[model samples]
Target chain A: MTEAIQKTVQPIGVATAALETKRLSAWFGDLHVVKDISLTVEKNDVFSLIGPSGCGKSTFIRCLNRLHEETDGARVRGEVLIPGAGKRENIYAQGVDPVSIRRRVGMVFQKPNPFPGLSIFDNVAAGLKLAGVVRRNVLEEIVEISLVQAALWDEVKDKLKKPGTSLSGGQQQRLCIARALAVRPQVLLMDEPTSALDPISTARIEELVMKLRSDVTVLIVTHNMQQAARISNQTAFFLMGELVEVGPTKSIFTKPKDSRTEQYITGRFG
Target chain B: MIELSSRDGVRKFSNYFWLAMLCLLAFTAIAPLFFIFAYLLVRGWAGLSFAFFTEIPKPVGEVGGGMANAITGSLVLMGLSTVFGVPLGLACGMALSELKKSAIAKMLRISIDLLTSVPSIVIGLFAYALVVVPMRGYSAWAGGFALSIVMVPIVARSTEEILKLVPASIHEAGLALGLPRWKVLIRLILPGVRAGVTTGILLALARVSGETAPLLFTAFSNSFGYRGLSAPTASLPVQIYTYATSHDETWRQLAWTGALVLVFVVFCLNLVTRILTRRTV
Candidate 1:
């Protein structure tokens, strides 16, 4: 089963960098949370960010989509660039709308948040409707495709009309993934997407994330070091708002250069 | 051992005593509602009939009469108030919740709080000057306008409270979906708080339904049924006030019937609101 899955989850042949951030810094009021950091993510690669709690890993990914600065007192000073239709576009440029930036980058939160009042089908269709796809048949087709891609179609096919909250915790998380996928974004950001689930659910989400690498670049923030070593092609370790080290997942786990990275991976210290 | 046992017995006696006392206090608080309901039912039972709902009041010496005009008039007045009050209140509430730290929001909140505490008679006088005087006569428009003012503060505060109860995470989730802020509010947040907003609207309606002071100087009840929005109108509260103090025995009996109907309507509204809000949460 594992070998067959690995064959299907092979990387799409795109070696160019999909996203680049230069000298990125963020602050809430006067307290700087994400210090100066630079990173690059390759197209169709599963990149995992592993760090201790409150280490600014989540904040860094949020900056990629401009969601970090949505808080009242929050501020960001950085250059985040994404691949546009034919050119690289700076997301923070004067005329660029954050809404458009967010549309290109989808996010799955730490907890499953399928809109409470919406049905299973509507939850997946919400993004398309917002983007002005009004045809009923179009919405149905895209919703079905997205759910199938998220690996939740078979379980939810007969109960699409039920409220989103009626699903189990694991199913709800997959539903959220479908909701994000329905928009067909170029990049997917996950903030500890499996921290709230059981072991079986966690494994299912990790498998789905691996399969998703063929279509979209994945950036995941997780505290689970084993998860980072398992699914990620490249892993970045953050400590105290700084990127201590980043390298191929196998090398980072086997022979990390930085003492902090080695200590954290060995369970010596957070 | 005897001394310790006696002390324990004393403590148990005091605990029972306090429990009984609290139950008595709770019963006392609710006793008047039952008394009023029972009195109205007993006094108003004979006045209730098919004609009472379908026919207008008769002259002083007539044997058969009804308060049909007052019933329809009250409906018109309350309906108008809801149409104006609910939307304005909801808008103000959204502003207050979204801009909680802004100076303008603080000022508006204080002003609404003051408006809520202002005497209803004072509001009646203000409406008398604002609408009745300008229109050159007392009319149902003036009455509805006055009741709406009374309703605005209640609706606004309750709406703010209820909207605040919605989790901030929901708002964040909507925004993260690339939805514009307005779309998030309308499509996502509003639907999430629908039951709470409905409850606030119903509570405001119930509050304004029995307000006699505001209508006294504005609508200035007419003996005939509703003529038009520009003309004077009769309402249950004002009609009951007029009949209860009259010298005729028949008018006083009809006044009790009007009171009973008003209470029943408000009771049903409150009951429905409670059920809706309970199920939503």
Candidate 2:
């Protein structure tokens, strides 16, 4: 059974570097939230950032989308790049619009805030709507395909008219995923997406994450080491706002090169 | 047994003490309403007639017509006030909620607070000097301008409070979707707080509906039905004031009817707004 599972889970296809950060850091006032963190995400792969609370895994993930800007004397003297037009686009360029950046790199927050005043259909179509695609048929197709991609279409197919917030917590998170997918973004960021869910819901989201690896590059921030091992192809462990180690999930768990990685994996201290 | 009795005695006395205090506070809040309502009902009772509604106030000693002129003028002024005040107030509220850190928002907030605390009588005088005297006469438009001054602050402050109550997570969600800030506010944030805005508008309407001092200087007193916005107009509260002070039995009765109508309209508006807020959430 183990051999068969290994064969089925073997890295199926080629991957490309989708996003990379060099010496990225975040700060609030004078306090460093994420320090000198550097990592890379490849296409069609699930890369998980995991650490204890205040270790800055979430901060690092937020920085990828430029959510946590270094304000009040806080500075990030690094580069974050996304591949564009057969080359890399430096996202930190002075004139680049963060709004446009966010459209290409979508994020799902920790709590399921799925545009409470909107219908389930509209919630999925928010980004497209924002980008000014008002065609009904096009919106309908995108909403359907995105929801299916997020594995939530079967449950919400008949209730597209209902408010998005009416769904259960797990379903709401999936709806948020679908909402992000509606824009057909190249990279999808999830910040503690399953921390607010029950165990069963968390398992379902993990399975969904694994499935989504084929369509969009995924980078998730999580506190659950077991979840990282289950869903991610690669795991990046963080400590004190620093990227301590990053490698294949299996190796990171079974044979970590760094003592801190081993300590964290073995539950010695976060 | 003595200890048990002593414990029971302590509990009973404390309970009674709290109960008495609660009752006193409730009574303190309600006493003025009870007395004023009772007074209005008794004194305004005789003026309750169809003629009372249709006639215009005449000379103090003589029988007059209903407050038809006042009623119509009040409706027209309040309508104009709502139109002028609600949107500006809502826009100010949106600015405060969405652009909280901006310098203009900070300045506008201070000004709104000042506007809210400025007395209604002062607003009336300001309108008279700014609008009525300049226009060379008291008119429904001037009255509306004064009422809107009172309304803008109430609507703005209440709207700001309501918008603030919406969770910041909602804004984050919109920003995450890559929607521009303006689009997020108009599409997502505003709809979420629609009920609150409506409630504020209604409350503002109630406030301006009963104001007598402002209209005294702006709408002044139109004994006969004025035909245009440029001419002086009568309103219910002003009619109530003039008639209630007169010795004529018929004038006083007409004032009672006008009072009843004004109170009923305000009450209905309040009830509907409350229900709307409840249903929305």
Candidate 3:
């Protein structure tokens, strides 16, 4: 058990990299959605990915957790490295389990998808329970902590027994966040998680994303440039399945190195 | 405005004419069902009595008897058929839904479709040849095996369609949580569609219980008591057929009440299935 835990843990002295990609590319059948792109997210950085519709930012993050290949006729070719056996291991390696990688790298989708059949408490504990953590007391404690981390604890703590879907749209999204956090992921991926919510709800999520940085590295894809400017410390610009520019969020907004990045961010053209 | 006004009168007349015609046609479609209900209620009301629920069949030409054995036999056959059919049908459906474009699924789909269209009587013959001849007796085992053949296709098809109705996104959510494929299915997917799958099983049961031709040769008919799964067993449909065709007036009357009871059971099953499906939606 200790060996297993040590294997998943990173070496103490190596420079911390929560997520890194090496020439990662993906395709849905013959249509390439994400081109070869190498990038790194420092541990605890709120990294934002900004792009136009169908620009492949969503597909890129999906590949990070190996979720892209789950689609019918979809395929990925790349290297995604996270902690494995006391070092950063390429997740796409032949023997690596995608499901195991996903547990370590949690995701919150664009639309809030709380398991409708479960209560709020069960929704947060689903990952833990599925991972073989079954004791009620252990589940209760982890659920409360995760909910508090997602900033949804106070609102839902009293009604943890209510169906997860009964919550308001924003609350539902936060519930999903809490669910993702319960498993203690080292990196969290948000695939335009606020696009389906109202401005106020979006504001709450943006705030939560910033606060989440204390524990996990965050990679967020968003159509809203202002959201990236407000919440993210670093930003990567993508266009036509390729990364155009990446830098500090302030610089990416104030002065982009690529002409397309300037045009797209400046509202000249997408 | 000119274009809209030019055809307004003609369009209005066409719309009203088709609407009225369709309403009449729709009523025509449903009229026979109400007529059947009224006819059965009137004809079968006299045959019902306290004895009908509590007593076993009194021998032929006798009065004041019940089809208690047949009722219990029908329940047994339904239970046996459900045991034999539901798990296999559910497994078939899961395979069909998961392997959408596979060659194996295509073949399985075609086979199930063909099985559904096969006459129930032919299924009885199949069970007769497969079980009756081998076992050298008509028994509840043969009857249930035959009825299960009639059930598998319905359950499999409905389960496939119902499982499909659950959006792919919900399934993906489970997978994203790092749950294994089977865990996601049992914990997330199946529970989400529990009512719907139950509706399919109930529908299959309704059809199975009402089956007359399939049980004719497979289960034969008994008047006294259920022997065992390996013994000839009585059933409501077979009993009704025998009573209806008998020379005795009292037997015919008993047949009407037996049919009424069977009809009520099927109607209740259908009603429950409807409610369950509504909950699923």
Top-DockQ candidate index: 3
Q: Candidate 2 — which pairs collide?
A: B47-B253, B47-B254, B52-B66, B54-B66, B55-B65, B55-B66
- Residue-level lDDT of model 1, residues B19-51, one tens digit each, is 999999999999999999999899998899888
lDDT of 3: 0.90
Give the DockQ-based CAPRI class for model 3: medium
How well is each residue in A45-104 modelled by candidate 1, as lDDT tens digits? 899999889899999999988998878899999788888877778898889999988888
Clashes of each: 0, 6, 1
lDDT of 2 by residue, A1-270 (tens): 999898457443213678888788788777887888767777877999888889988877777766665223545557788877677787887897778778888899899888867899989988898789999999999999999999999999999999898999999999999998888888999999999999998988888989988889999999888889988999998989888999999999999999999988899996
Lowest-scoring 10 consecutive residues by lDDT in candidate 3 chain A? A7-16
Give RMSD to native, each candidate: 5.6, 5.6, 4.8
TM-score of chain A, every prediction, order shown? 0.94, 0.91, 0.94
Most accurate candidate by TM-score? 1
Per-residue lDDT tens digits for candidate 3, residues A37-108, read 988788899999999999999999999888888888999998888877677889999988989988998999
Candidate 1 vs candidate 2: the DockQ winner is 2
What digit string (tens of lDDT, one per residue) describes model 2 on residues B1-281?
A: 99999999999999999999999999999999778778777876676777766766666677756788888888899998998888888888888876676788889999999998898899999999999998999888899999998998889888888888878777777777777878988888887778888899999999899999999989897878767988888888998898789888877777777787888788788899889788766
